[model samples]
Target: MKIPAANRSFFLFLFPLFFVFHGFVRNARFIRVTDCLVLTGAYFLAALILYLLFYALLRNSINAALVASFVMAFYLFFGFIHDPLRKHSIFLHRYSILLPVFLGLTVLLTLYLRKKAPFTRLSLYLNLLFLLSILYDGATLTWQSLQSRSPRFSTVAVFSEGQPACDTCAKPDIYLLVFDEYTGSRTLRDVYHYDNHGLDSFLEAQGFHIQGKSRSNYWFTSFSMASMLNMSYLNGISHPQALTSDDYTNVWEPLRKSEVVNSLIAKGYDIVNLSPFDLPGHPSTVSQPFIATNTKLITYHTLADYLERDFGYVLQRFIPRASKLGNVYKTNETVISRTIQASSLHPARPRFIYMHVALPHSPFLFDSSLHRRSPEATNVDFRLKDYLDYLPYTNLQAKQLITAIKGNSGGKAVILFMSDHGVRAWHDVSDFSYFFNNQNAVYFPDRGYSCLYDSISNVNQFRVVFNKLFRSNLPLLRDSTIFLQDSE
Candidate 1:
C-alpha cells in the first residue's frame, strides 16, 4: 500500500480543508458564503504553516504531514471530547489535565513517526476518507442550494388565496417594534412581583392599545416571529422534533422572505429592516445576539467553545475591555439609534419598518439609570432583581423611541409595539405558564383599535394590521400558545 510522496503531502492540506468544509456544509443555512470562504482560507493557511514548521523540524515529509494532521485533529476535536467527559465528571474535563494529555500524545506520535518508515498506508486511508467526505458534503450543499431556489414549502402558498389587492388604499408608514423578552404585565405581577403600570400607562396615553392577555404563539423567538410574519402556524411545515433541532434552515427561509413582507411589497410598501435578523433583499442591521455566528458554529467542539461556554465569566472578569464586543446593551443602543434615524427619513413610498430590539434579556447589561453593569454582575441566572432593575431602563428607552417616532411621523404612522416572547429564564418560578405571556400594543393613526382583542397572540398581530391598514380581509388566526420543551 505504497502511496506516492505527492499524494501524502496533498492529504495533509485536504484534511484541514475537509474539516472546515464539513462544518460549513452542516451549518450552511446560518453561514454566509463570504464567511465560509474566509474561514476556509484561514484554516488552510494555518494547516500550511503547521506543515512547514513540522517539515523543518522532522526533515521528513511523511512524518511532518502525520504530526501536522495529529495536531489539527486534536485542535478541532478538543471540545467534542471535553463536553461528554464534563457531563459525567468535572474533574475529567479540566484543561489543566486534558492539555498535558494531548501534548504527551502529540510528542509520542511525532517521535514514533520520526523513527518508523514512511506510513503511506495511513496517508492513503486518510486521503480517501477526507476526499469521500468532501464529495459527500459538496453534494449536500449543492442540493440545498437547489432546494432553496424552488422551495418545496413555499412561503407564498401560506397566504390566503384570492386576497384583495390594496393598491388604491391609504398606506400609512407601519412600524413593527419588537422588544425581545419583554414579559406581559400579568407575568410581571405574578412571577417577578413587579407592577409594569408605568410603561403600560405611558403606552396607553400615547393612543396605544395594550393587549393585556396577549401571549406568544411559540416559546422561541424564531418560531414566534416566523409564525407572526407568515400569518400562519407551523403545524405542517415544522414538527415538535424540528423545533428542538439546531438546523433552522426551514424556519429561516419563511422568516426572512415572509408572506407578510411579500404582501406589503406587492402593495407598494418599502421594507425597512432595522432588525437583528435578515429579511428579503435586506440584511440584518445588527448581528443577532441570540444565535451563534458561523465562526462559533465551525469552532464548536474546540477549546474556543469550551472557554466561551464555561469560563466566559472568568474571562470577562480579567478582560473587562473585551466584554463590550458582544454586549446586548450595545446592540440595543444601535437598534434604537438606527430606528430613530430611519424614522426621521421621509421615503417616497410608505415604509414597513421592522425594528427588533433585544432588551431586558441576558446577559443583563444595563441598570435602571442606563449604566452598564459590572462584568461579574452579568449572568444567565434569570434573577428577578436583575430583570427588575433592567426593566426601568427598557421603559425609558421605549418611551424615548415612541416619542421620536410620533414626533417624526406627526402622529400619522401606524405603530405596533410588541415583544417576541416573554422572559424565558424564570428558573425560580414554578408555574411555566408565564413563559408564554408577552407584551403587545398597537397604535393606528385613525384610533381604530376596536379590531385588536386582548387575547390575540403573535401569529395574529400582522393579520390584524393588514386587515386594518391595507383594507384586506386577512382572517385572524386562532390565538393559541404552544410550549416547546427545551426552548431556552
Candidate 2:
C-alpha cells in the first residue's frame, strides 16, 4: 500500500503550485507571463529547498516535504477564499487569528503521527487524488490562456478624415469631463430626494447648456469612456456584451487613435489625458512625471499582488485613516487639482483635455467643503445622506475647475461635462431608472451650436462637438440602455 518516498514528497510540492496556478488563471487578465513564470519558479524552488531541509530533519522521511507543502497550500487557500468574499454577510466574522494557529498545529501533529505509523493505503489514494486535481488545474489554465488570445479588432474608425473650412478660424480648446456615478436631476430630486437645482443653476449661470435627461451607452466606466472616446458603440467587436478584460484591451488600445482624437490631432490639437486609465504612459497629474518604461497595462502582477490589494478593505475595519492616496476623497482632490493646473496653464497650442474623475461615488468621504466625514461608512451599506452630502462637494469642485478653465480661455473653450452612470442601483435593485439617468452639460465658446437637445446622450457628445469644430459630418446614433446583473 506504501508509495515511494520521492512520489509522496513531490505530491506535496505540486499541490500548492497547482492551487496558485489556478488562481493565476482566474486573474489571467491582471497577470503577465513573465510574472507567472517568476512566481511559479520561485515557489517551486522554495518547495525544493524545504523538501531537502525536511529530508534531513525527519530522518529522511519524505512526509516532511508533505508537511511543508501542506502549510503553504493552506495559507494560499485561506487567502484566496477569505479575502474577497469576506465582504459579504455570509462570511462576516467567520475567520479569526486562532484559525491559522489551529491549522499550523494540525500540520505539525500530522507530521508527528507519520513518524510512528506506517504509510497506509488511504494515504496513497489521497496522493493520487491530489495529482489528478493538479493536472485538471493545469488544463484549465492552458484553455484560459488560449481564450485570452482570441481575435478582435484593435480599433474601429467611425469617421473619415476630411479638410475643414474652420482652419482659418482661431481653434478653441475642448474639455471632456467625466464625473463618475453622478445621477441626473430627476433622480436626484425623486430617488435621492436631494434637489440638484443649485448645481444646475450654477452651470446655467456659467453659460453652459444642460441635458436634463441623458444616459450613457454603457453602464461601466471603461466601456462607456471607450465608446465616447471612439465615438462608436462596441458593435465593431464581435459579441461585445460578453467581452473579457483581454477583449476590452483589444478595443481600448486604440483610444489615442480613435476618430475623435485623430480628428483633433489633424486639427493640430494636443491630447491631455488625466486619468489612471492612461496609466504608465500619460497620467496627467499636475506635478508627477509619467513613467512609461516600468509599468503595466494592469497593476496586478500575480495572485498574491491582487490579494494584497484587497487587504485594505480588511484594514479599514480595524484601523481608520483620514485619507489614503487611492481613497475617493484623495482621488477627487487629485482630479480637481490637475484640472485646475490644466486650465490655468493655457498652453500655446489648442488642446483636447479629457479628465475621468471618480467622485460622488463609493467611500463617500467628503462633505460640501472638502472636510472629512465619519469613517464608519467605510464598511456600512450605502446611505442617502452620504451620496447627497458628497454631491455638493462634487459640485463645488467642478464649479471651481470650470471657472478657472473659463478664465484661462477668456470664455473661448468648448467644455462637455457628463457622468459614466448614475447611482442607487444598490439601493433600488428593481428600478434601474437611477442607473440609466446621468448628468450632462456643455459649454460652447461662441454659443453658436443650436442643434443640441435635452434628450441627447453621452455617446453623441463628441459627435456633435466634432461636427461643429472640424466640420466632420458625423451623424448622431440612437441612444439605448442595457441593464446587467452581477451574473452577467
Candidate 3:
C-alpha cells in the first residue's frame, strides 16, 4: 500500500469554509448551522471535481489536486474577501450558504469527471477553460455596453430654450461633482420635504435647477457613474457568477467612444478626475485613465492605501476617521484636501473635473480626534451615534472646495452635484427595514422633507444635467423605460 503523493489542492477543502465562515462572522451577524452544513458539503464536493481536473493535467496526482484547489480558492476569496456576504444586500441565509457551497461543488465535480488524468491532457483542458472564460467575459461585456439604453430626462421645463449671453464663451466647462451619499434635493423634498427647503434654496442660489423628480438608475457608484458619465439611462445590472456552467458571467459595459469625456475632448475640453475612493490600484485609477481626456486626475486610492502611504493602520480592524481635530492628526485629511487642489486646476481649460468623494461613504467615522472606539473592547467612548456627525465639517470642507473652484473658474462653472449612492444601510437611514431593503437612497434624518427612492431612483439623474447644460428643449430623458410618476 503506497502512500499517495501530497495533493497540493487538498487545501481546496477550505475554500467553502472560508466563504461560509465569511458570512457567519462579518461585522457581527447571525446565521443557522443548517445553512453552514449545506455550504460545506456543496463546496467540498466541488473541490473534488476540480481535483480530478488536476489529475488529467498533471501526471502527479498531488500537483493536479493543487491546481484545482488554487482555482477554488481564487473564486472563494474573490467572493468572500471582497464581497462579504453579510454586508451585501443580496446575502440570503439559505442561498448565501448554499450558493457558494454549490459553486465549490461544481468545480470539484469538473475536476473529478476528467478521463484517465494525464498531466499534459489535464493542463490543456484547464488552460482552455481559463482562456474561454476570459474571452467570454470580454465579449459579453462589450455587447451589454452597446445594448445599454442612452439616458435623457422627462421634464416639462425647457432649460435649453434660454441662455443668457456670457462672452466668457468658455464652453460650459462642465464640473460634474458627485459627493458620495450627498442625497439629492428631490429625495429630501419628497421624503423629508420640510427640512429639504434649506438644500433647495442653496441650489437655487447657486443657479442650480434641482429636478424635483430627478432620479438615479443604479444604486452603486460603479453603475451609477457609468450611466451618468455616459449620459445614458441604466435601469439596473446583473452581476456575473459561475457556480454552474449555465451561470455565466455578467459585467458593466464600458462607455462608448461618444460619451461625455470623449465628446468633451473632441469638442476641445480637457478632462481631470478626482475620486476620493482612489486608493492605489483602485479600478477607477486604471479605468479613469481610459475614459479621461487628461491624466490630471487626483485620487486617494483607498483608506488602506492612504494609511499605508501616509501613517500606519494602527486601527486596522478598529480605526479612526481622518476628520480634522485641531492639528495633531493621525492620518491627515487627504480626500477633501485633494479635491480643493483638483478644483484649482479646472480653470485652465474648457475643463471637465469629475470628483468622486467618499469621506461620507463609510467606516462611518467623522471625528476631529481619534475614532470614538478602539479594539480594546473597553468603553472606547466613541459612540456610534452619528459617527458621520462630522457632516458640518464635511459640508464646510465642501464649501471651501467650491469656493476655491469658483475663484479659479472665474465664478462661471456648471457644477452638477450629486451622491454616488446612499449611506451604508445605517446611520441617518438607520431603520433596519429601510436600510436593508432594495432601497439605496432614502429620505432619512427625517427624510429632510422629501424622499427620492420611493418616488424616483438614480435611473434618470444624468438626463436633467445634460438638458440643463446642453440646453435641450427635450431636456429630461422622456423615453426612460420606467414609467415615472405612476409606478405606483
Candidate 4:
C-alpha cells in the first residue's frame, strides 16, 4: 500500500517542532537556559534521524529503517521521561513513571509489525496535543517569572511588663499548638460529616477562641513554621525551589537564634518543648532526644535517606532478588513509643516549647495504644476511628502540658494550634496546593471529609484564639466545625 504525500510532508515538519517543544517542557526543571539549548540540540539530532527515515519512506525503503528511527525516538523521549542523566530529576523519587517505558516498547513493536496508519495517526494526535501543552506551559512560566515578587517577614514586638497572671497565677504561656492535616471545626462537620463535638466544646471551655479560617502561608512543616515563626509568608526567597530542595529551607533560622527565646527567658520564662519528636530531654541525659534545631544550615539530610544508606545498595545491586528484604525502612517505633511516655519537666524557666506531634502520617499504627479501629479499606474504611484513638493520645499530651504549666503557678498563657497539611492516602498528591497550582485552598483525600480541605471552613481558628487571648472578657471557645452527621 502506498502512503499519501500530505501525511509524509506533515511528519517531516511536525517532527522537528515536536522535538523543540518537548525539549523546552522537559528541561524547564533544570531552568538554566543552557540546559534548554543542550536539550534542544539533543532533540534536534533525534529529529534529524527521524527526518532521514521520513525520506527513506518516500524512497520506498521504509521497512529497513523503521526499527532504527523508532529506537532513536524512543531513546530521545525516554531520556527526558526516565531522567537517567539529569541531576535535578523531578520524578527521581517516584517509580510510577516507569510505566510508560513498557508503553513505548509496545509502540515500537507495532511500528515493526506494519505501517499501521491508525496507530500512526493516534501518535501524531498525541504529539500535537503534547506540543501545544508545552507551548502553553512555557508561556505561563514566562508570565509568572515576570510577575514574581519578594516576601517579607515582619518582627513582632513583645508587650506586657508584669509576668502573665491567670487563675493558675504561674505564667500565661502561649501554646502554638499545630494539628497537622486538620481543618477548621465547621468543615469537619460540613465536609467530612463527622461530629467534632468534643473538640469544639473543649476549646470553648478552655477559653481559647479558634480562628476558623486561619490560613497557612506555606505548605509542609518547615516553610509553614518558617512563615509562622517569622510572622510572614516566604516570597522574597525568589528561589521558591529552595523550599523543596532542602537547601537552607529553614524559615525559623533567624528567629531561632534571635531573642524569641531570650526575651521570654529574660522575663523568667523557660522554653518548654512538649512533643518528644521535636525535643528530646538533653544531649547527655537518657530521658529524651531531639533533632538538632540546625535545619537552617543542614537543608538536605546530606547522607542518603536512612533506608537507602542501609539497604538501597542491596536493592540496586540485586534488583528483584532482594524481594523479601522489602522497601520498608526504619519506623523509629521504639523512640516514638517511649516518646509519649518519657517526660522531663524544667520548672525553673519561662517555657518556649515547640512540639512536632507525630501521627496522621503513614504506617498508620503509631503504637498499640494509638491503634486504628477502622477496617483497612473499601466502603467501610474510614480513618475516623484511627484519628479518634490518636486524638485522645494527642489531647492527653496537651492536657499534661497544661497541667504542668498550671502546677508551676505560671501567669499569662498564649496558645496557638495549627496543622502543616492534610494526609495523602494511597499516594494521592491532591491534598497539596502550591503557588504554581493556581489553587487558593488545599484538597483533602478521597475519604470525603471536606472540612479539612475546604476553603471557607478554615476561617475561625486563630481569629477565635486571638480574641480569647487578648480580650479581658475571654469566653469559653466552642468549635462548630466538626462534621457529626456524615463524614466519608
Query: In candidate 2, what are the lDDT values of residues 392-447, reduced to their tens digit?
Result: 77888788889988998789888988898888557554676568789898899877
Ranking by TM-score: 1, 2, 3, 4
Better of 3 and 4 by lDDT: 3
Per-residue lDDT, model 3, residue 60, is 61
Task: Point to the candidate with the largest lDDT.
Answer: 1
Give the clashing pairs for model 2: none
What TM-score does structure 4 among the candidates reach? 0.41
CA deviation > 4 Å runs, candidate 3: 1-169, 185-214, 235-251, 254-258, 276-283, 286-335, 346-348, 367-390, 424-475, 479-488
Return the top candidate by TM-score.
Answer: 1
Which regions of candidate 1 are displaced past 4 Å? Answer: 1-7, 27-30, 143-157, 236-247, 293-297, 312-327, 486-488
- The local lDDT score (0 to 100) that residue 471 gets in candidate 2 is 66
lDDT tens readout by residue for model 1, 1-488: 33234345677888877887888887676667787778778777877777777777676777788888888887889877886788888785788898898889888887787778777787788888889989999999889877736432344345533678766779889999998889998889877889899999999899999898899988778778878888887644444634444534446666776888878887778898987666777776576546555455677667666666555666677775444424455677788998899889998899899988777666777777779777667756667788878898889989999999999999999998889889875566787778889989899989978888989998888888888877788767678887665422
Each candidate's number of clashing pairs is 1, 0, 59, 78
- lDDT (C-alpha, whole model) for all candidates: 0.78, 0.65, 0.43, 0.39
Model 2 — TM-score against the truth? 0.72
Residue 162 CA displacement from its true place in model 3, Å? 21
Position 373, candidate 2: lDDT: 61
Q: RMSD of candidate 1 to the true fold?
A: 3.7
Q: Which segments of model 2 are wrong by more than 4 Å?
A: 1-93, 97-157, 160-166, 236-257, 279-326, 368-370
